[model samples]
Target chain A: MKHLVLGGVRSGKSQFAERWIAEQRKQIVYIATSQVWDGSMAERIAKHQSYRPDHWHTIEEPITLADTLKKVASEQPESGVIVECCSLWLTNLLCAENEAQLTQEREQFLAVLENYPLPVILVSAEVGLGIMPINALARRYGDEIGVLNQRMAQICDQVTLVTAGLPMTLKATQGK
Target chain B: MKHLVLGGVRSGKSQFAERWIAEQRKQIVYIATSQVWDGSMAERIAKHQSYRPDHWHTIEEPITLADTLKKVASEQPESGVIVECCSLWLTNLLCAENEAQLTQEREQFLAVLENYPLPVILVSAEVGLGIMPINALARRYGDEIGVLNQRMAQICDQVTLVTAGLPMTLKATQGK
Candidate 1:
């Protein structure tokens, strides 16, 4: 099953996705995309780490998400790999690489979503629901993230949008 | 019918609300909460005005929304009032007023929602689904908006969440 979970900041998307995937009873591979660049972010990361079972294999990969997924599949075919979020991964790529490089990475990631082997749950931020950002960087990030979510939703089997700590399934697999 | 329409930017909340109210065949009092403080904002306001029906009465009230609503109800109780958005109204209050003034204004607005005489439709932005803002002002705005939405949702007769141009009814009057 390929599931895409989306929400705003503190929308309980990560916790919801985690619980849903855990219910499947598969060995979990938690693919974290965040890098602790600041003190607050480090605290956030630590808080997230505390909730998950200590045995869940954790992989910290800010970029090269597609490559990491491929490697995980080969090593643990039966395990469900969770991509903690696409927004932070895109942020990393946006800041570190040029447009072409980011495009290449995004394309590769989408291509892999087409026929992913393992049960994969991709978490993403739904950031387009507010006012037009006053800053250029935030606007650019919103545009990229919105486009990525649409493309990912088209390919993924299921998509859930969380709001106010509630999960609403926007797209679901038919007859499953 | 009092309806609260919530969505992210470009999620079509305004259009959806406009269309819904237009279908009711009542005169609309478009209570805009934005003041054109800059060139970009002027453009945005102009663009919005262009799409709306020419005959619809428009009122630009950045603050004193509750007072304006009261006046509108008395002057044109038969007409439907559309508060263009709560987010902008809150933004106006956040910037111009002290905490005490803002609280009084917010309380008055909620008090009016309890039994709004005329058919009213309120629009708001659902902005909590994203990364924690990096700045203090943005963070404060997000927190305020989130709490406001929750309180508004509890009071409104109907709450519709718009996503990608579709409206999902989150709460609706029973037997309606």
Candidate 2:
């Protein structure tokens, strides 16, 4: 079952995803896609690390998410995979300033996700539900994330939007 | 029916609200809360005006929404009202730099909405579902809007979040 969990910052999306993946499988492959660029980001990464169970295998990959997912699915067929978030992964790509890499990576990720044989849960930021940012990059980020979300929602068996620590299901398929 | 329609910029929120209100009542009162601050805003307002039906009564109110709502309810008891948005109204207050007016107006609007008569639909930007802004005022705006959305969701009969022109219900009462 492929599930997409989307929410705003500090909206309990990570917590929700943690509890959910724990329920799906005992051995979980926790994929962390964040890179510590600043002091605040380092602090946030540490905070997230503190809450996670020690037994779960954690892999920090800033890019090449598609390859990572494939390896996890093949290596541990019995375990469930949870991508902590796609937003930061996207940020990493956007900041790289490689348009070709961005396009290729996004397409590759989606193609890999189409028919994955595991209980995978993907988390992403719902950044489109806000006013347009003044910065050009921020605006571009919003547009890209919005399109990514819409595409992911199409493939995922269930799509949930979190707000104020509450989960609201946007789309759900039978026998999830 | 007191409904709140939440969405991002160009997320088809206004169109959704208009259609929803049209289904509820024939005599519609459109309350546009946008203030023309620049050329872009004026063009956007003009575009919105062109799309709306000429028969619908339009009121341009930048502040004192509670009083305007009261007057509308009293004068035309049969007509339904759709406030184009609360976010721009918030911007107006913030730009004015009058902290007292902001608090009083927000409190008053919520109070009036709690037991408002006739079918009314409010449109607001779901600005909290994004990254933390770099600017102090933008951050404050997000916080204020988040709090406002939570409060309004509590009092509203139905709350719908629009994304990519799709409507997803967050909260709904039995009758609404």
Candidate 3:
């Protein structure tokens, strides 16, 4: 079983996932996808790092999420694999600029999930659920991430929405 | 074939790997394994993020190394899969506290390299080559990561030692 989380900014989605991952088992591995390009984002990244327990393994990946997930999953498919959110990942994928590469990378990431070996938990932002973006690229990103999430949800055994520090199960097939 | 990089702290190993990954004959996907927990690390992460070109795909994973690699290998196994550094990751795995889980994870991580789908590169610190540490845990980590790297070097197709921004191939094997 895998848990897919979606929510808005400051929606407590990451916190929910972190706390949950910490509790799942002793061998916790946190997969972070955020890149600290600015002071604000740097602060955000630091805060996320400080939250983890000392023993949890961490791999800093700004891209190649699907590949990294496969690596971890293949090694410990039964262990917890928590990727904070896929929204940023989708953004990264679409930002590849080359249309063919972007499409190819997208398919590759999806394939990683499709053949995922363990109980993987993923968190992503709910793009376009509230409002459509005015800018072309922003709108495209929103649409793209929404599509990515749907593609993932279609295959995920469980899906949950995190709002106001609350978790409402969306696709709960079998909660392990 | 994958190009391996081994070095000490602040030796520009990551920058070297980034450059190599960027100069690849295929699309680039960064598989990061660092998470932010403090102001210092956040700043470091931000600096790295800011330096990256806008077109590359980024995947944020603080953990789950083997699974991610396998997925990328399966998707683009022939291109390149350069995973930056295994020191921290080995530390993360050893911190599991559960011997069974630790051994399982270690075995799994090592096993993925045997018949991986892609040409892979691994960046790791030569921690043990330096002076022994004063602290017990620090020394343990140094020892553990050192052993991990040595074993990886044995299985890897090629190994390179990077010192003062120069790379010397220590071991080489033709990849299938």
Candidate 4:
């Protein structure tokens, strides 16, 4: 039941993914990776927070993603798990200001994906379709995230893209 | 040669679509639908503006979408377009508050899309992949946008999804 949901900003991708989780008949752990470093983001994050059911356990991991997922979802067999998003985690990884640390963190994150248990669902942004970033760092970030996404898509059992609020499964799955 | 690029917020989706446009050897029109109603949006809009060549014709149409596209894309064979995004337009349509008007407007948009010449690439968010929305309007807006996206995907020559800064073209040809 591993799933990948990808879309652009305000494209209704998040609401679609959340609805999917609400319908699932398993205990759930909602993993959110947002760090409120600004005012608007704080507001937006708050809006998102108010939408979840109180009973659904949530773990906020600004970093340390692999370890967090392993710790939270390792024991839940029947319940599904969600990594709310990947783009922020990638941002956090890229902006660590330590190049070696960034590489090590990314590799560790990728390594954790290999055998993580639970029917994991990941929400991530599809950011490479727009423009060629004019800066060196933005381009590098894009490339690295692109690689990470491809690996996720290859490993995940399903890949879903929502546009204009519609959900269309790219890597089709038969899960109810 | 029509194309649509879909991705998540800050997902580098806009940049990806912009890069695709920058590579085009044809005359270009940049249709920006974003309204800089606040400071954050203004900053983002400014960042995007800095990326373009000085000669590319620009059209700022927050409404009247079909008429604008038809007007700008009518003349040349080698003309291509980039719609910076559809989310704002979706919001525009929602705020119109007239179901009949929204229907008429969207129909006009589809009509304009029907016979437009050249490669027009639309950039939109892949929203609706998250939890169920809290309000009726939000839920309805999500559904409406989803319908619009599927219709556009059906008509366009190519549909690509970007996630974590990577893109995979799901539908690459018209009527496929």
Candidate 5:
């Protein structure tokens, strides 16, 4: 089973995804894609860590997410892999890689996602709803994230959107 | 009937709101809260204008949304009013006012919304779903928009979130 969860900041998407994964009764492998670059982000990361159970395994990988996911899947094929978000991963790539590298990395990530054996639950931000970004970088970020989401939605078995602490399934079970 | 339409950029929120209002058979008054400050913004404004029907009344009021809505309501009591968005209005307020004035304006807007006589469809971006802004202004904008969306949802008879052009009702008319 594959699930893609999307929501805005503080909309309870992470909590909801955590709860859903917990219900799966499989070993949980949380792949956190956040790199704390500032004090506020460190706090946010700490807050997220506190919410997660101590028993669950966590992998903090800021880059090379697809490679990390592949390793995890190969080691624990039965376990459920939860990628906390795609936005941060994209951000890291945006800062670290050139355009060609980003395109290659994105493609690699998508391939890994398609071939992964475990039940994968991915969480990402729905970023395009706000006002047009004033600067070039923010605008580019928005466009990339939007496109990434659309691509993920196409491959995932279930796609759910969380808003104001409410979840609505956009796509369910492929056929049902 | 009051509806709160929430969506990310290009989620077709405005189109959904416009279609809903068109079905009402009442006079349609679009209160757009964007001021074209640059070429990109001007293009956006023009695109929005093109989507709107020629017969529908349009008001391009960047600030003073509550006052404009009130005046329109009194003059065209039978018309359905569509506020293009709340974020831009908030942007205008943030740019033009001190904290005290913003509070006063927000309060006044809420009061007016509460007593609004005609059917109203309010559109706003669900901006809180993404990353935490690094700067004070962006962070402040996120907090204000999230709070604003919550407040509006409470007053609205229907709250719908649009994702990839799909509209899902988060809250609907009670018992109806």
Candidate 6:
């Protein structure tokens, strides 16, 4: 079963995803997509790392997500993989300024996810609800993320939005 | 019934609120809280106006929301009121730089809404889901709106978060 978990910053999406993957009763593979660009980001990464169980196999893949997922699924068919977030992954691709790489990576990831073998959970930020940003890059980021989320939601068997640490399911496929 | 409708940009929240209010079978009072701050904002306001029905009584109250709501509830107890959004109203208050007025207005609005006589639907942008803004004002707005949404969700009989033109109920009081 594939799941897409969405939430705003500090919305407890990670915690919810952690709990959800644990419930799957499989060896957990936590894929961290965040790349620390500043002091605060570093601190946030540290905090997230502290919250995670040390025994869980953690893979920090800022890009090339599709390849990483394929490797994990093939190597450990019984593991439940959690892509800690897609928003940061998107940011990383955009910042690289490699248009071809970005397109290929996104398309490949979606293709791989559609027929993934293991129970995988993906986390993303729902960032399009506020006033449009004045910065051009910020606006572009918002548009890209919004479309990505819609596409991801379509593929996932279950989609949830987290707010105030509470889970609200958006879409669910029964008996999946 | 008091409902809080939360959504991201272009999340179809207003359309959902309009549909919900119409189902109530009461005369609709569309309280638009958007102010024309720029050319883009003016265009948005015009577009929203075009979508609304000609018969629905429309009131543009950017600030002074609590007083306006109180007046509407008392004078038109039988009518259903729709506050098109709280995000813009918060922006107006923050831009005005009046801390005391902001505190009083938010408090008054919540207090009045709790026991409001008529069926009321409140719309707001869930703007805290994305990357933290670099600008201080933007950061502050994010913080304020997050707190405000949590508070509104608590008071509302039903709370929904809209995404990609779909509604997900976050909280609901049974038979309410």
Against the true structure, whose DockQ is highest? 2
Candidate 2: residue A168 Cα off by (Å): 3.0
Give the per-residue Cα lDDT of candidate 6 at A113. 95
Taking the tens digit of each residue's C-alpha lDDT, what string does model 4 give over A39-137?
A: 999999989889887788888987788888777655666677888789888887777777887777767877877676676788887666544334767
Q: How many residue pairs of model 4 clash at the backbone?
A: 46
Compute fnat per model: 0.26, 0.37, 0.00, 0.07, 0.28, 0.35
lDDT of 5 by residue, B96-155 (tens): 858887898899899999878888899998778654566888887887887788778778
lDDT of 3 by residue, A1-176 (tens): 66788765544678778777666666777888777667856976887788777877888776778778878877866577788767776666667677786787678878887767666678887745433536677778767877888998998888876543446677878644
Better of 1 and 5 by TM-score: 5
DockQ of the two-chain complex in candidate 5: 0.20
Docking class of 6: incorrect
| Whole-model lDDT, model 3 | 0.69
Provide the TM-score for each candidate, comma-separated: 0.60, 0.62, 0.48, 0.55, 0.61, 0.61
After superposition, the stretches of candidate 6 with alpha carbons farther than 4 Å from their true spots are: B1-125, B129-132, B140-168, B173-176
lDDT of 2 by residue, A1-176 (tens): 99999888899999899999999999999999999899999999999989999999999999999999999989999999999889999999999999999999999999999989899999998777765789879878877887787778778888888888899887789734
Interface RMSD of 5: 3.5
Error of 3 at A51 (Å): 1.2
lDDT of 1 by residue, A43-152 (tens): 77998999999889999999999899989989988788889989999999999958888999999999988889878889999987655567888888989999999999
What range of 10 consecutive residues in model 4 chain B has the weakest lDDT sum?
A: B125-134
lDDT of 6 by residue, A1-176 (tens): 99999988767788889999989955899999998888868977998889988889999999999999999999988899999899999999999999999999999999999999899999999887666768888998998999999999999999998885568888999625
Which lDDT values do the candidates have, in the order given?
A: 0.86, 0.89, 0.69, 0.76, 0.85, 0.88
- A9-86 per-residue lDDT for model 5 (tens digits): 767788889999888756899999999899978988998999998988999998788899899988987688899888
Model 3 docking grade: incorrect
Per-prediction DockQ comes to: 0.18, 0.24, 0.01, 0.06, 0.20, 0.22
> Candidate 5's C-alpha lDDT?
0.85
**Top candidate when judged by TM-score against the true structure:** 2
TM-score of chain A of each: 0.97, 0.98, 0.90, 0.90, 0.96, 0.98
lDDT of 4: 0.76
